[model samples]
Target: MRKLFFYTKQQFFNFKAMQTAAGFKLLSMSQLLSSQKVGELNKNQKYYVDLSSVMGYTKTNDSQQMLFEQLFDSFGENIDFICDKMYEEDIKYIFRYIFDDFSDVDAASEEIIAEKETIIETPSRKRRIVDLNDKELDDFFKVFDASLYGHERFKEEFKKLVTAYRVFNKIGEHKILSLFLMGDSGVGKTEVARAIHKALGSRTKLAKVNFGNYSSHDALNSLIGSPLGYIGSDGGELLKRIQESDVGLILIDEFEKADSAVFNYFLDVLENGKVVNSQADEYDVNGYIIVFTSNITKENFRSKVSPELRSRFDYKGMFNLLTDTDKKKYVHFRVNQIISKYKEFVSEDIPDGLHDRVVCEVDVSKYKNMRDLNKKIKDTFVKLIGA
Candidate 1:
């Protein structure tokens, strides 16, 4: 009969010592029991079995206790069962009842001792987001109002969305708030997400997935991933971007450009508030706000998007071109920003009247598109600075 080994939780994760001592790789109990036969070992070879998963299984199914005992016995001398100290008594009793000379091996080998001195440390992968207290939520609204310009109706609706999300997050069935914005290009459709990210005080880049780049046949695979056992099957661009971001907001720009597969995938995501990659790993986006920006017209939107998907959006609104007054405000904001940056870095003093001069130079009436307005501001700034 093989002796059962009890390890501390710390020791179980120390792969080098465990692998060398057992003369085989370590595997969780679930992996060993799974139907996949890719890495199956022969009868004579030994393997280290992680008992944590076994403990969880046996706790749920009292009837499986006898079956697991029989299966462990069948592995015979080829398996070394490794478990944490808390499960020692249960494991000991199960082994003693099945085998006559069940005992634990307590002696530490010289190799294990040496390997312990050089234990490989793994970096933690814990994700953290900026959490707002009640006081902070009020401050968040103040910042949001100042940063986002124009579209007063949408702004009011967004505030209501945030308030509802905070109040009902714990009890509501819907876990995510999804907004669909459709309008002409440069109408601040994408800016809505930028404003929210800034209001959250996020220092990291906003999580963005542009569907304009994913119009191919395998767009779903490129967005999530190919299935396991296939090439390039790692968590795809969307997951990677989300993991890198500090805020719980995702921007899908040019949303109408994606294939139907991508649309269906997102419908499932909006419904469940979770995204499952092709590898079967799931990411929780419970408190997230996903904004979809599109250039599709109202008529095309109804025709292109299915009714089921269209109905899932929490708010669907068309963003209009910024009013002339809003454009003037944006011009003043941009000029001030440029002047502030120049004052901070340049040794030469900028003229006190430079902002007014630059704003006057930019004829806002000539430009309806925000992108074109922004270009004019940049051009005027350069000309004034050079003069």
Candidate 2:
């Protein structure tokens, strides 16, 4: 059986030596037809190459793709394809067109070697959950509980989870605290991350990635960065956001909308407790909280996501619509905040009844989502101030 060499760019030196020792010639797709030097090839000789590097999923011209196809048709049997950090299906997609007698479903054997890890270290502002002291952790929880309305049960569960995580994490047991929140849209699903960000006392934006935009065929490239140095050659949105944030929290919005490649990539992140970006920069997220929010129901969550991934979550809970009482409390809290801001910025001569009058204009039962309720509160404030 012929062995198809699959190695990462980090292990290129080993692959180059091993392939050259054999009869196979090592040639890039660019060097195959584009190079000026022409050499006569012996019949039945083998060659190692990256087929999709020049003939990529996107951006490669029709003429270039046709050239690769013709090259494959001529040397399909005489070629041992080299895959650089690419999935097997992607490699097969290129081969599907050339070989009509393609019977090797799983013939590509991965070359397993000791990988030399490449890390791009930057001065990062990393304050992990494990770093917080007792009083500081209490302060964080206080802010977290106050910022998010309702979910009393979830808050209690989260407190217990964190208390245990702190102990286990200190002993090198637990790595990451992951939450899979399944709920309806606008039901304060993302509010969990916002509350955590506020509680962390960060002076910067929250680290968030909306997977709705990552549902494309090349979603993985956009997320972790494209190989061969496209836009995300520096490690995609995930690494960039993590690097920029001071807090040890990551919010992945619309989790169910992401591609399977993304799902597989995150599986590794959760298992390893570190993010190795496309540029090979290694960032430790051991004490981080990665919150994944999805609008999918309990049934879909089971049928859609894989079981291996489903078991990795520390907590999976559903968020319900805020009760009328909770909503009223939120309205009051928001109005009081607006009044406080107005007094500090615009005028401190506001009457005491102004708070109650503003709250009275709004009916919480009219809205299902907190966003709409917030909008109603804003409109009432504007109208009352105009009067």
Candidate 3:
């Protein structure tokens, strides 16, 4: 049986899981080192070490190298190692010097085959709505429509584009459906992604990356990860989130804030339907939906975005603020939903007309931002409940 194991950074897709057993013990490199010093280590115990957290690899230490040799020699079996790709060279050193049987697992092992079959491979996975047939898609759209409170015009345009995309997709003409939504804050822009995620029956959260927090100089590096082999380098947050999600939708929020490097990166992603990280690891995003939401005005959009990049968007729709009537309807729905939850959780009695009372207090015309309207609803509910 193979005794040495290395959990690569790619495997930590926003979630790392392990099962604890009676003989199994999880340790950081430091903890293992401490155990080595005390001579308390037991060969009967299974060891899992997160070697990535060992920062002592700053320079080659002869004592540490000898310790590793002695440590493993003490317990030859049942050892799991983790290496953040930053220290692949060091892990390789250990692999060559210590374990000659296999690198990560036995050559042509079933475990490696299963890992390749599941994680980071696009072909093995099913595309959510893209895999849906005509009748199935129609049903999905209905659920998507009801999930959002407003944006009727954008919804209609989306339905048409999706239908056209489905036909083009079959012929290999269209690789992905792109939506470039321009809007003010709090106008159901990101909600489009959430709705699609829910409608697609994904139990995981929507895959999303917001460029607003990134500076122009470092945006590309952060998006795809810093160039490989850099200290603390790993597969990027974007790819990890995509791997974590079970759906085909990806949301890029605050799109205009990202620099041209990021823009060009995505332009290629849109064109090729494959996201290649700095490490040259490819993630195929074909048959996926990529939604880009930006708050830049029409004038600024034309000025900030290049024409070549502009032409790549399949649908560029401006999301308008909800109408007062729609806002009122939203308030009513929220109130009823909140009251039902309150009843379920708190088991409290409420006035028969409490929903109406809460709804009437929220004046939708006074707030243009749906987020502000939502806050008002919550405040009103709390006040009425306290009364």
Q: Write the candidate numbers in order of decreasing TM-score.
A: 3, 2, 1
Candidate models: Cα lDDT each = 0.72, 0.73, 0.73
lDDT of 3 by residue, 1-387 (tens): 233454454444311321121123455676656545435543434556666665456345655666666555554445666556566666666545665543341122345445544653354364466788766677568668766888888889888898889889879999999989898999989888887876665656779999888887898888889886799887787888888887788999999989989888888988999988888888888899998999999989999998888999998888899998888767766676677568758966986667778877888899998888889999999999988
Candidate 1 structure, TM-score to reference: 0.65
For candidate 1, write residues 101-132 as lDDT tens digits. Answer: 43333334556645633432211121112246
Look at candidate 3 and tell me the lDDT of residue 324: 89
Residue pair clashes in candidate 2: none
Better of 1 and 2 by TM-score: 2
Candidate 2 lDDT for residue 138: 80
lDDT score, residue 5, model 2?
A: 43
Off by over 4 Å in 2: 1-125, 229-232
TM-score comparison, 2 vs 3, better candidate: 3
Error in Å for residue 81 of model 2: 73
Pitting candidate 1 against candidate 3, the one with the higher lDDT is 3
